[model samples]
Target: MRRLLFWLLLFALPSTQAAEELRLTNGEWAPYLGAQLPHHGIASRIVAEAFALEGIEVRWEFHPWARSLLLAERGDRHGSAVWLSSPHRKETFFVSDPILDSTYYLFHRKDRPLHWESIEDLAGLRLGATTGYDYGEPFQRAEAQQSLQIRRLGSDLLGFRQLLAGRLDAFPMDKVVGFDLLHEQFSSAERARLSFHPRPLRSDSLHLLLSRRIPQNADYMLRFNAGLARLRESGKVSQYLLEAQRPLSLGR
Candidate 1:
């Protein structure tokens, strides 16, 4: 009777299983990525839910953008989200399909009233841009040739503030993000002073970058992409993007 009771008790106990976790790295780029925001931001939420469909949980490590890239390269983490695809990075990482569209544009004070039809149009102006970020080949080439006086900073938040202080005539950043940050870091009175140029400086798609050094990462990549496809087919991706536009869309 004791032996039978022992077996029955063991079989009746609930079974516990540990969830599979994917460690991903990234940096703060508001509305897209902010450690304090819900699901660590919109892009992060999308990536997490996509993987969740495959029974994978995401654990994000918020680091500086460059450091986030380094983490994936070193295989300290499985992958990094929200990076633009480049030939060199593609050679080293398993790049995912378009995670989101990134649109870069010039931002300046409303009082200054600056407009640039082309790269050459902004000649002689003091420009500000984020360090370690690629705006585009032409913009980079122009910077290399000293076409405009450029000031490099680590964050667009700082760059925008500097522009307000008259330290920089113009700064460049993502349109959606700029708007997102504007409401976050400034009040309506302060926001009235800044404006984004109608012409986009450059446009690119963001991707999830996975290191090739990890033997099993290839399979993980396939699962993530497949899950992402299901989300899109079910209209979840569209719904997410529309919701993301809420703070900016409703007010503006």
Candidate 2:
């Protein structure tokens, strides 16, 4: 009789006691995801807001980009934010609709004059890139084939400094990010010397990808997509990104 009573009480308990918090990991990629920026930068705010719309709270872990994606892929974390899609990632994780479209550009000194019609055109130059960045399949394959000369450093800041010091021939990054960092980190005179090639290297959409380890990963993607659509309809997504793009004083 006591056992029967315990089962009845347990069954009667409300299952909706509280919503489980979703975990995500990423690192500082400014004007996109930054712990110091408002709403933790545009991408962070979008991810948080999307989950919030579904009554889910987010628990974010900021770490290096490669490590963060690895955790999510391993199911140590539920999801990862603001990442470009790749064949391996598609096979490994459930990806949602694109959160943002990013354009990759090659930044170089104005005096050097750099141009590229194809990845082949960049073969001999010492290309500065961040470690573990997904520069798309073409660039990766070329690097693997030893068709491109690649020099990797810790961060864009390091790469930019290397370029300034003539240690790197060219550095590639998102145009918006390069400009923002240029504005934030360089003096007026320094800014004048830097410019990006007119042609874009590649344009790709960034998405929030869910780990396959989570049994309900697909459902989570659906919820996030719906929330993202709603946010788009409400114009919050555009507004948020524009806010992040506000110019910062180049020199303090």
Candidate 3:
């Protein structure tokens, strides 16, 4: 009878508790999640709206990209949005359904065209990358072999400046971020003089990477996915993307 009662009680127990809030880690990247603005950027707004649908409050912690990633890896934080998914990271975390599609493109002087069929084509060229920015699989693997010259810049703005000044031969950055920096840091004349490689290095979906250590990750992911589904059905996601890209459309 005791064993029967125990089984009944176990079955009666709640499957999962409701998450009171979500804690996200982010860095200084803009047009995604800004360190200074809590509600800015497409990812930030999407996450905020998704959690709100579940009655979960959203909070953010802005740190250096490496430190923010470490916190997520250690399960000290819930997740980080706008992160690329990889097989290695999949072992430690659950990635949400893709929040957005992203492309890594090569930035170069407009006067000089860089023709490259693949990432390997850039071998022996000086390339600038922001510190802690993952270059996806091929570039990451190629970089490991020391086949490409990589200059790690402290910030995207600085890297664009370096590229413009001819200090670096090429730079790989997200298309949106590269465009944002070009407009924010360079004059119209200067911006007009810059261009991206004809082809993207890689195109993939970006996701909200939830740490496996969080006990409520499954619940969070479910709720987030549900909300995203509703958003997509209602065309809310498309509207948000349009708004996010508004600034880019001007004069482009």
Over the stretch 67-119, how does candidate 2's per-residue lDDT look in tens digits?
Answer: 89899989999988988887788899998899988988888887888978999
Candidate 2 weakest lDDT stretch, 10 residues:
243-252
Tens digit of lDDT per residue, candidate 1, span 1-252? 999999999999987888888899989887888899888988998899889999999999999888899989988899899998999988889998887898898888888989778899888999999888888988899999998789999788899899889999999988888888888787777777888788989999998988988877888889899888888888888887776663543134
Model 1, runs deviating above 4 Å: 1-17, 246-252
lDDT of 2: 0.85
lDDT of 3 by residue, 1-252 (tens): 999999999999987976688888876667778865547577888877887887787788888777888898898898877688889889988988988888888888876778889777898788998777777788888888888898888888888888888888888878787777777777887787777886888889988888999878988999898888877777878887766552543135
Can you give the TM-score per candidate against the true fold?
0.90, 0.86, 0.84
| Better by TM-score, candidate 3 or 1 | 1
Clashes of each: 0, 0, 0
lDDT of 2 at 46: 93
Identify the runs in model 2 with alpha carbons over 4 angstroms from their true place.
1-16, 246-252
